[model samples]
Target chain A: MSELWFYILAGMTVAAATGVVMLPNPVHSALSLVATLFLVAIHYASLDAHLVAALQIIVYAGAIMVLFLFVIMLLNLQTDPDESPMNATAAIAAGAALAIAAVLGRVFYAFGTSGAGAELPEGFGTTKALARVLFREHTVAFELTSLLLLVAVVGAVVLAQRDKHDARVEPVEPVEPVETEGQG
Target chain B: MMEPLATPAHYLVLSAIIFCIGALGMVVRRNLIVMFMSVELMLNAANLAFIALANRLGNMDGQTIVFFVMTVAAAEAAIGLAVILALFRNKPTVQADEIGLLKW
Candidate 1:
C-alpha cells in the first residue's frame, strides 16, 4: 500500500516538475512548482522526516511559492514571442543534464540500500531531535544563519528601493513643515 | 529477476533525476524568474537527498543540514528576486538573453 503511494507520488512529482520547466508562462510554471513542492513534502513524510515535511509545506510551498506568485503577478509578465524557450543551446544543455542523470542513476543503483532505513535513534525526525542537534551541536552555524537572513533582508531592501537621486531626475528637497497651530 | 522494492537507492535516484530536471530548466528557460524557480527545484532535490540519507544513517546531522539549507534558500530567494526586480526596473525584460548591459 505504501509502495503504491510512493510510486503515485513520484509520478505526480515528476509530472509537476516537468510542468514547471516546460510551461511557457511564469504563472503556470509557478503553480506547477507549487504542486511539485507539495508532492516532495509527501516524499519527506514517507522518509520519516515529519518535522522537515511540515517545514517544507510551510516554508517552501507556503511562503516561498506565494512570494513567487506575487512577483509574477506584480510583474504582469506575458509570454515573449521573440524568444523561444528551447533552442540549440538548450538542447546541448539537456544532453549534458541527461548524461549527468544517467551517471548518477548508475552510481546510486550500484550503491544500493545497504545502510538505509536503519534503526532510528529515539525521537528521530521529531522537532526535539532536530532542535537538539541544531542548537547543541551546530549552535554557531544557527546563529550565522540568522545573521545571514538579517543581511539578506537589508540587502533586498537596498537593492529593490528606487534611487532617490537619479542622474535623470533631480533630488527633491525636504520641505520644512509649517506650524499651523502656532501660526494660528 | 525479482521486481525491486522501493529502497533508499530509489529515493536517491529520484533526487538525482529531479536535480537534473532542475538543471535543464535552469539552462533551457530564458526567463529569469523561471530560472530562479529551477534553482529552488535543485535545492529541494538536495533537501530530499539529505532526508533520505539522514533516515538511512540514523543521524540527526543530515536533517540539521537540511534545516540550514532551507534557511539559506529563503535568503537566496529574497536576494535573488530583489536583484531581478532591480534589473527589470532598469531594463524591462525578464528574458535572460535580452539583458545585455555587460555586453561590450
Candidate 2:
C-alpha cells in the first residue's frame, strides 16, 4: 500500500519538477514548483518524518513559495520567448543530468543491504525525538542556526531596501555612446 | 521479485533522480527565479534522503540534520531572492545573461 503510493507520488513529483524547468512562463514555473514541493512533503510523510513533513508544507510550500511568487509578480516577468526547447544548452544539460542520475542511482542501489530492514524506534521521526537530539547533543549548532536566520533576515532587508538617494541620483543626464566613441 | 515495501534504497534513488532534475533545471533555465526554484528542489531531495536514512538507521540524528537543513534553506531563499530583487531593480531584467555588468 505505501509502496504503491510512493511510486505514484514519485512519478508526480518528477512530472511537476519537469514543469518547473520546462515551462516558459515564470508564473507557471513557480506554480509547478509549489506542486513539486507539496508532493515531496507527501514523500516525507510516507517516510514517517511527520515533523519534517509538516515543515515541508508550512515552511517550504507555504512561506518560501509565497516569497517566490511575490517576487515573480513584483517583477512582472513574462514567458521567455528567446529560449526554445531544443537548444544546445538544453541538450548538453540533459545529457549531464542523465549522467549524474545514472551515477547516483547506481551508488544508491548498491547500498541495498546494509541497514535495509532495521526497525525504527517508536516516535523515531517525531518532533519530540528530533527536538531531543537537536536541543541536547546539537544545541550549539541549533542556536547557531537561529543566529544565521537572524542575520539572513537583516541582510535581506538591507539588500532589498530602496535607496533613499535614488530619486536624486538616478536621473542623471544620458550620455550618448556615439560621441564617446567618436572622441575615443 | 519486486519488493513489497518501499525501502530506504527506493527513497535514496528517488532523491538522486530529483536532485539531478533540479540540477538540470538550474542549468537549462536562464531566469534567476526559476533557477532558485531548482535549487530548492535540490535541497528538498537532500532532505528526503536524510529522512529516509534516519528512518532506516533508527536514529534521530538524521532528522535533526534535516531540521537544520530546512532552516538554512529558508535563510538561503530569503537572501537569494533579495539579491535577485536588487539586481532586477538596477537592470529591469531577470534573465541571467541580461545582467552581466560585473562580467568583465
Candidate 3:
C-alpha cells in the first residue's frame, strides 16, 4: 500500500466525482462516474479489499453505468450547455450542503488519527475470506439481497413496459382507393 | 496544506467533499435523472468513507457491507430509472419542477 498511490488515486476519484456533479451533459456525468468508480475501486484495492475492487468494477462501472447511459439515451435527456447552473435557489442549497460537509469534515478532523487504529489481519480482504463471512455468517442477508434483486427486476419490467399512449388517431394522408386487382 | 504522506484524514476529507458535491448536485439539478446520478455519487462517497474506516480498523465487515451496498444500489438504480421512465412516458418530461400535476 503505497502512500503516493493513495494520494494519486484518491485525488483522481475526487476530481472525477466533482465532474459527475458539475458536468452539464448527463452522458458526460455518467462517464465521469465511471472514472470515479474505477479510481475508488483502486482505492479499495489499496485498502486491501481486492474482491471489492473487482466487484466494484464489474457491478458499478460495468453494469450500473451502462444502465445509466441506456436510460439517458432512452429518454434523450437534454444536455445543458450553459456555463452557469446555479440559480439563486440552487446556489443557496449548494451553500447549505457545503456547510454541512464542512461541519462533518471538522468533526472528523478533530480526531487526527484513525479511530480504530487496528492493524490488518492476515487475509483480511481476500475473496475467500469475504466469501466465508458472506456465505456463512451473513447467509440470510445474502439471500435477501438476491431476493431484492429479483423483485427489482420484476418491478422494472412492470413499470417500464410500453403500451399505447392514446387511441385517437385520424388518417391525414388521402387514402387512395384500393384497386381491387385480384379480389373477386 | 499538502501532506507529504497520505492520511486517513485526507481520505475522509476527500470523501466528505465528494459527498457534499453529490448533495449539491441533488439540490441544484432540475433533472430527475441527474438527481438520481447524484444519489449514486453520494453512495459512492459513502462507500469510500466506509472503506477508509475499514482499512483503518482492519475489518472485513466493512468490505462485506460494501458488497451489499453495491447490490442495493444496483437494485435501486434499476427500479428508480424504471420509475423515471414511467413518469416520463405519462408526462413526457424529466424535469422535477415540471411534473407537478398533483401538487396544490
Cα lDDT of all candidates, in order? 0.85, 0.86, 0.81
Which runs of model 1 end up more than 4 angstroms from their true locations?
A112-117, A166-172, A175-184, B1-5
In candidate 2, which residue pairs get closer than 3 Å at backbone N, Cα or C atoms, i.e. clash?
Answer: none
Clashing pairs in 3: none
Interface root-mean-square deviation, each candidate: 4.1, 3.2, 4.0
Q: Candidate 1 - CAPRI tier?
A: medium
Alpha carbon RMSD to native, model 1? 4.5
lDDT of 2 by residue, A1-184 (tens): 8778778888999899889889999899889999998988887787788888899899988999999999999999888788675798799989999999999988976775464467777767777888888888999998899899999999999899897587545455345665688899
Runs of candidate 2 exceeding 4 Å displacement: A167-184, B1-5
Tell me the TM-score of each prediction against the true structure. Answer: 0.90, 0.90, 0.86
- Error (Å) of candidate 2 at residue A98 is 1.1
Q: For model 2, how does the per-residue alpha-carbon lDDT over B1-104 read when each residue is reduced to its tens digit?
A: 12224887888998999999999988888899989999998998998888878767778888888888989999999999999999988888998888888899
Give fnat, all candidates.
0.71, 0.77, 0.70
Tens-digit lDDT string for candidate 1 (A1-184)? 6678678888889889888998888999999999999998888877778899999999999989988888888899998665465778878987898899999977876664654456777777888889988989999999999899999999999998886467325423322234554576
The order of the candidates by lDDT, greatest first, is 2, 1, 3
